[model samples]
Target: MPLSRQLVLSLFSIFLALFIGAVWISVSNTKNFIEQQLSSHAQDTATSLGMSITSYIGDKDMPLIETMVNAIFDRGYYSAIVLKDADGKVILERRNPVSLEQVPSWFINMFPLSPPVRVTELNDGWTIAGQLSVQSDPGIGYGQLWDNASDSFQLILLMFLVGLVLVWFLVRMITIPIMALVKQSEAISQQKFDRVELKPKTLELRIIVDAINLMSERLSDLFGRLTNQAERYRDFAYSDELTKVGNRRAFDLAFEQILSDAEHQTSSFLMFVRLSSLNQVNCNIGFLEGDAYIKTVSDLLSEHLNKQDIDFTLYRLNGGDFALIIEGIDEVTCLDLCQQLIDKCNAIEKSEYESGTAQIAAGSFNYGDRKKAILEQVDSALTQANFNPLKWQAVDKLQTVQSNDTWREKIKALLDKDTADFIAQPIKSFSGDEIYQEWFARFPEPDSKQHIPMAELIPATIRLDFSQKLDELLVRCAFTKLSSQSGTVGLNISRLSLLKPSFQHWFVTQLTQLGAQCSHLVLEIPERCLFSDTNNFLSFIVNVQNLGVKITIERFGAQIASVTHLRAIKPDYLKLDGRFTKNIHTEKDNQLFVHSLVDIAHGLNIKVIAVQVETAQEAQTLKDMQVDFVQGFFVGAPIALEC
Candidate 1:
């Protein structure tokens, strides 16, 4: 119960007890007072009548004696009045049975009143001539007692109401500070430090308030320091000194990081921007003018990229070569952005800096889990764009690895119709125990047996705005496949689907309906998506995990800048990108990276899974690195589960 209700009930109970006691005592006392008054009244009337009737009895006037008795009885105060001779013979008598008006039978029975009969001797010239007797009515006294009780009850009821109001007010006042403390504590749970501004008047509550305020202040300071440290580390390691954008070191980190993240590995755009003929401009004008030209291009790229609201990283690889990695974008949007960059370059004041026109080249590809491969491909695309800078052939070199208009239409039909074929890849741990089979969707070519890999098809789904529908189909099928199984089945969710409201609702509802099967399911999310709008993603993760599904970060080391979120989210598993595990035995740098990644993940009790383990030597290296799970062709290739 809430404190306010408890207090009110407690007060009401006490009031009820006291009121019952008071009414009982008041009723008892009133009954006794009425009884005594009735008895006294009867005695006085008999005495007074005896004195007045003596004269009439002495005269032997029977008519006068009868008249006196009749007059007293007619007054309605006495139930009976009688005149009798000394011989005990009744000479005159008047009597009437009394009935009370408006008094209930129950009340009269509970407070029964019996008035005493009084007899007085009448002396006729010093001799007792006759006796006069009178009995008072009990009805009059009962009516008075009943009226007194009714009035007392009304008064008591009024007091109870007034007392209740006062009690509620007092309880509310006492609880105000307590409610404030509760709200402050709830805020702290959400990582928002807040203090109790109102000091309680009670000594115990005052102490509690002081403690809450001190704790909030300490937490606020600590979070501020940690956030600042993370930002400083990001700036020093990745940002270029002159441009304040990512330096070459930053580009290397971002490229490795994005490739490591399974979610961002595929369906991303990489744009390479170069200041064309800058050396000639430096010879014609000055080094300072060339620097100005680079700065101008940097500003243009930053301004345009920031406006897109997509997750992208920018880096200045060298004086004139710039690189951009934009995630969750379609080919057309990527081409449009490339055109915008080209326009900005063409619009650059060439005469002012004595610089040649700018050259921008862009390439789109589904990451095959290879960092070096993407770097080479984008570099080749940049070379192609420079061949004809005069025509500003920036958009021509933009190419997608598996995307064409025909492929998109085919993939769309497959997804919309839910007719895509899927294959499952078995993932085995270092202990040789199969953890789960990772499911992949395949779309057959228009007229050939060749099928499009998921890496190529997923980007199209995202670009086409129907990733949610495809994800729903995939989840349902995976659940159906694992219905009677005792082992876990894992599948990747579309990043685009995670961002959609309708998709989240449908996914959560489906998982709930899966019942026990949900417990045997593992879901994969790309780590790169955690860098921006993380609250929504975290909420999504929690909602699904609440249904007993395990959540793992695919390509765990993809975006190092947002690694702090891992501690807060605590995902069940972190899969190291395939690039890191490809040749782990011979590559010292890769081994070192895996060692650090495993250490961090273990510290938080998050198990690490190594991907693309191609050889026995690489698997041994991963085990030595303390990797918790391993997956590759060396262990086993993806095979259909025997249903």
Candidate 2:
């Protein structure tokens, strides 16, 4: 029961007890008073009548004696008045039956009062002439008693009502602060630091409020520190120490990830740039001047390449060597981009280089094959470029395996036919309880027997501007599956999907059509998507959440700075990127990074889920760090839909 109800019930019981006791005492006293008055009235009237009738009896006036008896009997006070001789024979008598009209039968039975009879001796000048008996009827007494009881009942009921109202008011006052505390407790459970501003007059409650406020402050401070630690840890692991570009480890991971995608196979290129005479420059110009020259070259390469208007990632490979990876470009465009870098490097002149300017070598290779083959080709091209100082060359160029028309036709057919099959991968809590299953749409690969991952297909879908259609299909398939399943299902929705008004309308209509089944749907978006156009993203999240669909952010650790934005629009789940999950148990930095991320997400009331968990040890470490959910091959492989 709620605190308010329990308090009200307790107060009401006390009021009832008091009211019952008061009424019982009042009724008992009223009954006794009415009984005493009736007895005293009968005795006093008989004594007075007997004394007055003595003169008449002494005179032997029978008519006067009868007149006195009749006079007293005419009054309604006495039920019967009789004047008799001493021999027990009646001389004169007057009698009336008792009549109680207003009194109730139950009341009379409960508090019965009978009039007393009194006998008096009438002396005739010194001798007893006759005996007189007088008794009062209980009708008037019962009537008066009933009236008193009725008045008392009305008065007691009035007091009871007034007392009950007062008790209710008091109970409400006591429970108001308690209700506020209850809400505060709920917020705390959700990892929110909501405070109780309601100040209760009760000393004990005031102390409790102070304690809760102190706890909230401490929790906020702790989470702030953890968030800072997470940002620093990511920077230490991925950032290059000198140039601030991604380090070699970061490059290796990103390269492997890109190569894993089957769709970008023939459209990506890797460029190798080497600065010659770096050792001679360091010996002559000192390490500081050499470092400055390297930084200048790195900045100029990035500036000119970005000016070319292409998608690329620049990384410093080693002391005097760097690499650039560009995607979705043809072979000729790739050669033109390498020439641009060579021209920019040749233009640089240093006044304090011992009269020698910087010499740069460049090479380009395809990114579709094995990492070793790609590196070997780029190195071979670089060897050729090193022969000619301050120039670039390409030893190998990636040939177009298939035309864009083929990709467009294939994707269009899938979108038109809506025959794309999806697989479900289960994500479970630390306790092994199934929370939901994440759905992945399968795409046909070049080899007929194999299928490409959703990650690989998404880039092509975005390139073709068919991401909206893809999202619609995914949502449709998810809803169809969820309509019959008893568990929840999560679907990944692209940022492009929300950009289209038609897709938004379709999403709303489908949710409405699904009705209650929509509750089982969870939509996940990349965290990088929220970094841009935050207002619309938040609005979109709110709109979907209002329809009972949950929202989660996948690949959450890409930009650690974005966590600050989570406070305003907290998502239901913050799925840590698989990069952080790689070798987490053995890598101290990865463990710390994940721990801090969890702390930050929890502070914002968002659940932390570790994806790509492939080992028992990794899952155990994640559980120890308080991650709420886990998803990967080790937990369960993706299963095709039965239907």
Candidate 3:
């Protein structure tokens, strides 16, 4: 039972016991008083009536004696009155049976009242008259007793009702704060630090409330510190100190991740830009000016690329040197982006550099490209740009790929016909137990049986502006497939599509239509998403989660602000970036990093998933770090969706 009810019942039981005792005492006293009064009344009446009838008895005036006796009998106080002769023969008698109209039969039977009879010797002028007897009727006494007890019972009931109300109030006063404390404790257990605001007056309850509030405050403070600590950890390891962009180590980690994701096959470019005036500026001006210029360049890159709605990461490899890996765009678009960067930088550096702005070199690569090969191509182009009049060049373009015109038409036709196939890849626990599956979209080449790799297809779709339609198609197809599936399925939604208000509305409507089936679907987005358009992304997440759909953050360790953002986002799953999960068994830094990430995620009540688990050793290592799930070729390979 609820505590309030239990308290009320307990107090009411005590009151009930007291009430019963009171009624018993009242009834018992009334019964005794009524009996005593009856006996006393009978004695008084007998003595007086005998004295009055003595003269009549001596004269033998039977009519007069009868008249006097009848007068007393008519008073109705006595049940019977009799006059007997000296020989013990009855001369006169008056009798009446007891009548108790007001009292119930059960009450009367439970408390039997007997009429009291009294007799006195009568005398007639010194002669003994027959004894006169008078018996008192208890009916009047019983009626008085019943009325008193009934009034007492009613008065007790009123008090009892008033006491019950007091008890209810008392219970509420005690339980309300206790219940609030309990709710606060539950929220704390779920990693939500909400304080109990109500202060109770009861000493014990108030103490408890103060204790809980103190704990919550301390925990909230601790979480804030922990989030900051995580940010520090990420920045120290991956971020450039001066420019606040990815450091050389971060770029390598990201590049390694793309290289490791052999199944998805990503196609993108590696661009290198070297400042033409940084050396001169640092020699003529101070290092502070050079640092300021580098910072400006970093900011400009972020500002310009974020507007493109393309996935890219800019990095500060070293002083006067920067690198960027831009994805989800065609070669022509990437070249155009390069030209814009060159022009924009020159416009800012007319006074600093006679040779104009920085030299830009772009080299394209696909998944599985060697780190050395991509770097050498881009670095050689960078060296060549120093001599070229334009100070910009594109090297090793994807020669085998179709032109942008061909891709636009192909992607448009495929989206128009809904001609993409989907496959499912299982994410399983370390024990090889299946947890859930993720769906991937596969598109075939337009006029060939061979399908274009995802590396090429993703960029083409984005460049052609077909990402929104593709996202819609994939989500709808997954929702349809979920109807017959027993477990949930996941789909990756592009950031470009998610930013569109129209796509957001359509996605919400589609999720609502799923109803119960929404539980069977999960949406995954890159962790880098938080670094841009975060408000819109958060709003989208709220809508999706409100509809009972799950959200997973993929490429989770990509952003330094992930810990702080995760606190706000509260995704259902946090899939670690492939960079951290690769060779986890052999990398001590990776182990420590993954362990902390897992701890932080688990602390927030969010499960951690280690992605790109390509070996049993890595899976076991991740399990040791307490990753909740693992997914990759070793755990399960992608298979055609049955439906």
Q: How many residue pairs clash in each candidate?
A: 2, 0, 2
Model 1: residues with Cα > 4 Å off, grouped in runs = 50-66, 79-98, 114-135, 195-214, 241-244, 247-250, 257-271, 275-294, 306-311, 326-340, 349-405, 420-451, 462-643
What are the runs in model 2 whose C-alpha is more than 4 Å off?
A: 54-75, 78-113, 118-162, 240-248, 257-369, 372-413, 428-436, 443-460, 463-465, 483-488, 498-522, 529-552, 561-573, 599-608, 614-630
lDDT of 3 by residue, 1-643 (tens): 8988888889999999999889889989989988888888988988997888787784468999899889988998888998898778998888898887778999998888886678899876677868988888888888888888899999998999999998898888999999999899887766678888898989999999999999999988887677677677778888899988889988988888887686556668889988888888788888888888788878887888877767788999998899999866667777888888888787687587655658999988777779898899899989988898777888955343687787788777777666667788999887778878988888777778777677777877777677788788777766766788898888888887877889999999998888988877788887777776778878988999999888898887776445557767889998888988888899876677777777788888899888888888998888878899999999888998764
lDDT by residue (tens digit), candidate 2, 1-643 = 8877877788778878877788778777877887788778877887898887787774468888787778878888778887788677887888999887778899889888867778888787767788888888788888888887788878988998998888788877788887788888776665567778988888988998899888987876776667767777777887778887767876776676555433123356778777665676798878997888779888998788756535566888898788877765555566666767777776785545443333333333333558887778777777776665535667644444445677677778667666556678899987778999887776555436466544335546656667778788777766777878899988877666765567777888888888888789888876766766678667766778889988888877765636546765668998887767766789787787788888877767788888778889999999899999998877887888776
* Top-scoring candidate (TM-score): 3
Cα lDDT computed for each candidate against the true fold: 0.74, 0.74, 0.83
Model 3 stretches with alpha carbons more than 4 Å out: 54-59, 62-66, 73-143, 194-197, 217-225, 383-391, 396-420, 443-453, 456-466, 496-519, 529-549, 562-564
Indicate the worst ten consecutive residues by lDDT in candidate 3: 559-568
TM-score of 2: 0.73
Global CA lDDT computed for model 1: 0.74
- All candidates: CA RMSD (Å): 7.1, 6.4, 3.9
Clashing residue pairs in candidate 3, if any? 266-455, 267-455
